[model samples]
Target: MEELFKGVADPVRREILSLLRLQPLNVNQINEHFGDISRQAVSKHLQLLEESGWIKIYQAGRERYGYLNKTAFYSLKEWLDAYLQWGEQSLENDHGVFLEPTAYEKGAPLTHPVMLQAMLSKDKEFDGLFYNAVRTTGIFCKPSCSANPKPDNVTFYLTRDEALKNGYRACKRCKP
Candidate 1:
């Protein structure tokens, strides 16, 4: 746990973990996702993450892929959850700040799909059924969006559970 905390304390390492949490990526692919960083720098970060047991590497085809090791996140989750509780209270006490509906309670498993294939029901209103955020622009989009959606690298979630189940965090602005 100490080693995990040490590795995640760095901002760059956290970024790497967040990316890996989405999907496995090889060294070159990870570098491309974070285009501003030098390849060598990303490699060093991956090395530290591996040493801390936060990530596992496996060979896929011609390249090595890195995956986030869930067990290593246990301690970090506790630390963050402490504040998450406080944030919930703060929001409840102050209606001045708008709070989006959370898909899950702390310590509970996610309930939404990562990508949903459901055809929109004709009668369901778009109010809570469809959601997209400006930050995810060009990423996964709903059929209801006014813009052109991106490639398949992005995904759709049927329920909040499916999204959380697949490790995609909730959007803050346009809460899905």
Candidate 2:
């Protein structure tokens, strides 16, 4: 746990983690994002993260890129789960157990109101926005959110029926 914290304690390490989450990047590209830091400093921070098992560095082209090693985050999750489970039990004793298996038990489906209809009547802006919004959730989309991503973790839908069926919600701005 201390090793994990140590790897994450520096601002440079946090920036590296954020960048790697988006995509693997070479040390030079990573350094480009940090104007104040030298390439050597960025390399050192990347090295620490690599040593702590939070990142991986490998040769690509003529340079090495850094990538997030997601498994290390699982270790941090295990540490946090110990205390979270205790709190859950305490809450169960104080109130009644939340027996519901799904957290979205109460959320209503999007109505796709007249406003959405008007928006869709335009040059398919609604569909384009809805598709782009789903990308933020890391899902590949379809004309109608047709389970294109296939896997539940990545699938998203536009219609309330589709979203409710596959467990997605309307975008607050797009209101799919």
Pick the lDDT winner: 1
| lDDT of the candidates, in the order given | 0.61, 0.60
lDDT of 1 by residue, 39-158 (tens): 899999999999999999998788999998877777678876655553556543442222234632344443323112111221112334544322354332333443433333445454
- The sequence of per-residue lDDT tens digits that candidate 2 reaches over residues 62-102 is 89988888889999989977545534455523222222223
Which one is best on TM-score? 2
Residue pairs with backbone overlap in model 2: none
The residue ranges of model 1 lying beyond 4 angstroms of the native Cα positions read: 78-176
* Candidate 2 positional error at 128, Å: 58
